[model samples]
Target: MNKSLKHLSRNLLHGVLETLWIWRDERVAARLGWYLAVATNRMPAKYLICRRTPVDVELDAGEDELWSAHREAAKVFEETFGAVRSGELRLRELQRPAKSLMDLKVELVKRMLRHCNFCRWNCRVDRGEGAKRGTCMLDKVSRVSTYFHHLGEELPIRGLRGSGTIFFTSCNMRCGFCQNGDISKDKDNGMVVDPALLAMMMWELRVEGCHNINLVGGEPTIHLHTIVEAISLLGSVQPSRDKLVYLWMMKPDALSWRRLEPAQYLYEGELNAPILWNSNMFMSLETLEILRELVDIWLPDFKFGSNACSIKLARTPWYWETVSRNHKIIYDWGEDIVIRHLVMPNHVECCTKRVLSWISDNMPDVPVNVMDQYHPDCFADPLSPDYDPKYSEIARRPTREEILEAYRFARRLGLVFESISLEKSVFGLRP
Candidate 1:
């Protein structure tokens, strides 16, 4: 028993070390060396906390109070990005004329890299020096695990063709049962590319008839600089837009020839196609603020509604309180929002129900995809020493009964998602 325990412990520690400064390919090693040699430090004059800590969020607000808050949030959203786009929200094209918005965001991202707090980890590793903290395992050079037109993402996102997905390598949050373990668990899983090459990749996807460019990961927000800059670069080389058809543009007609008030972003050339931010939703407020105006859709995963479940399964602290609160904010801020939750074997009562209640209670309009495609993976293997018997309750696939109950519960809560796959046997269509 002791010998087996020691072997498992050693392998886990080796895994941790490999996340930092380890490379499978020598080409990435050479590029990393080049980045470290030329990259300049942009450390802040004073470092302050960038992550939102646990606070006393009143989860049990009355219907009246919740409705009032939601209304106010909607009003604020309309005023900020309404028929006349305000200067504060559209600063890129407003005040900063003749300057590249992408360049500015890229610069800010590089500076942010010096103190690396893009996610909840807040490891404060100076990635600009081309070395990331253990959790993310990505340096200044962003590695892309894969890029393709994915039709499997929920109907709205995938659309007729598919959502153009660029999956980044390495992750900040390590879920023990992550389906994409080969891509997310290791940094050496993909080819390293700079922002320029990433831009070219997006252009290729656009030419290939992709619907929207979906930024996914291993937590894609970790490579905010690369993603933002790549989008900016792609927009620049392609045709510039006359007006931005945004949140309210869900309806279209033959009124194009009649010019009323133009969409706010006529002055700037941003992403012509809709950009979807497909993330874990464990993001920084500052990062969200920077991307609020840019991202057209928010496709976030509502992992666990119980902090205890999150701590055990995803190894995160205050995951329920932190991400749920963030989800409320994101729902009101974005043009369109989609929440994806995977129903674990035993988590229906503790996690699934709570998540559904919150969404129905506060964000009724936001679409949700209650996923049922979960099964035992690398960490959950019954024979693996790393598998804790305590979690055996959720070590197997969720049953057909549980799936049916989940759909019934979601429908009972008055939640509606046109794209939420009701299919019990399908994989990848969950979100």
Candidate 2:
């Protein structure tokens, strides 16, 4: 078939199967259904709920005290989430508290900036001072490579409208075969965006009908403060009598020419977009604590199976321990999650098989995408001036046989991955 015809056929079949999945699978429906509800304003985003749940901790509370407060507030947030999920509480009925969990998160993340431990590397460079950079090569300020409705994500993540993708600059990991090297490696590649402007970017994507606000990166974990602050700003933008004056005084040069109207900028209603944490699964436990209340869905990458392979391929230390711990935390938390495992060239035994086996043994029910789109790029690109002979093993695409074997392994494990895997061709046509 022609490309266009083939595309149409695939989409039609996909839509049909997606509808059935939503109807049949409770887990699938809860995640995608809640996202759809938030996108359509039927329900409030998780951040909005966080904004409504009250917290009594002081901004400068001691580390132990603050964490205690966070724990208590988390219980309340969970209870509230349960009520909201069960239809016992309506988003309209949720009123913003004087000092909320969202506010506390903003404070905690800012404090973390002083010591900079967003990722497991724990660079402790005092990003707030902007004097030193971390392993991610990012200071306090975040740079945005781009923001748009990205249609190229996994089926459920993209949905019909598309996943609202905001690509941040710089990553914690130095993957030799990095596909988005331009964004991930270059700290100065994109414009530095403040919290307000970042929030505006999110608002624009939602206004254009995106399903979820996908916070991706080089890695989003490095920009935890900026991202959480942006979400807080987006959720708390209520129309007020001093709105015009606020808009006039707060207009930055970046937003001047395309001055948003009061309705758009002020955002009269709750800013509703499910926060999708598209991450590398290398975030600190502290970062994950804050995220548990904010993120509506988790899209994490399980890149390496062993620390040795990770050290060699991604140049990350203690990778197996850190990534697996984070994944188990989120999975056990009962969060909506979809895991992505990229199939690389020549490491199926060391990486692919181990990753699949671990998922089967631990998180068999989580939707996984065993991706086959690896290509030679960045340091892995032999043509690049910076190419190294040591990384030549992954310099080509995975063979068709390798991809098939990976799928076969996943199938043998009885993994719940068909929705995101190539098995969609047959699974989508199922009765």
Candidate 3:
């Protein structure tokens, strides 16, 4: 079911059931159904909005106009579940023989930049088109600690505008809870450029209209040749348009799967959007067999259903059998994968019912977003001997009935691709 997600599976299931009639009401689906039932559960503790201030002075202005009218009624429920106003979807079918989510997202970003091994310091960093730095110190240029246009994310990545992120700074896995730990533990001299000015910043985020181009954070597969020279200079200056671009990677290993071979040499025959990796699924199985041929959205990040908080948050040590064998190779490569699971305030029912109920008994129709946006930022180390959050108390915040009991365990794990919010579960702490 790849060929452009089988032509938008009945328009994204009627745009997520017409986003409950463009959010007619029901307190934005019971405040995003208590953060989508513990973010689909594997339990890392969930819920947060235990409030101490902010959240626009505690939900006013008519709950921020029902959270921007449930995000424009969930983009008219993905334009009636599956959206496609002409960004074409026949992403590969000429004589049909399968394999063509734009040639498996440019042969999975040029086979993760020809065997990149993205992060974990395996730095096989060649990044094609002449090499540079690696060991997560990053060099082949992709620097730029920030970019913008991020209307909060999710909802099929901020549709009616915003989602063109960027970030990229430098990290392989230093997490102590790194809420952008000052440019992922900055050593300075980053923001470097020139790869045709990073493909004119992805054609200036598609001429600032932005809807997708999010290649985020200090670990973009340790700079796969500046992300294949800014997606090969925005697919040769919009060779035929239809090239949205949205990558988010966070290390899945094996020379960052050879940077998905420059998205099929820059949007091979056009219509190329969705290649997000946003990892932490931990790797090998030959980097999930090179992300089943150049991903198209596998956001990954199951944090922990408890290997005692995935060996204490990302220090690794096989965190829950490598995020359940790379979430069953991203649910046997399908269901436009999303699963994000971060609710962290007191471990949402053991990280959402034992790791989102073992990813809803093996990818029950993939979609689980369930993030409670943790905070306690910039984790100060203070001579780390191991774990600290300044002498616990579970570092404060996270209770709204423990994020609605991790959103009623994502509807008892039947999980129909749930998403949640309750004002992004606050968490800016620091008093």
> Local distance difference test, per candidate?
0.60, 0.79, 0.48
lDDT of 1 by residue, 305-424 (tens): 787888888888867766887788866653467688888898898988889898889887666778878887758757666676766777899998898888889889877642355522
> Which tens-of-lDDT digit does each residue in 271-318 have in candidate 3?
233335566655545445433333334566676786766556545555
Worst 10 residues of 1 by lDDT: 43-52
Better of 2 and 3 by lDDT: 2
Which residue pairs in candidate 1 collide? 154-431
Off by over 4 Å in 3: 1-167, 170-176, 179-182, 185-189, 193-196, 200-214, 218-233, 237-274, 277-335, 342-351, 354-364, 367-382, 385-431
Order of candidate numbers by lDDT, starting with the best: 2, 1, 3
lDDT score, residue 108, model 3? 39
Q: Write the per-residue lDDT of candidate 2 for residues 87-194, one digit (tens) a residue.
A: 898866877788999989998999899999898999999998888888887778898887666778876777655677888999999998999999999988787877
The local distance difference test score of model 2 is: 0.79
Q: On TM-score, who's better, 2 or 3?
A: 2
Instruction: Report the Cα lDDT for residue 11, model 2.
Output: 45
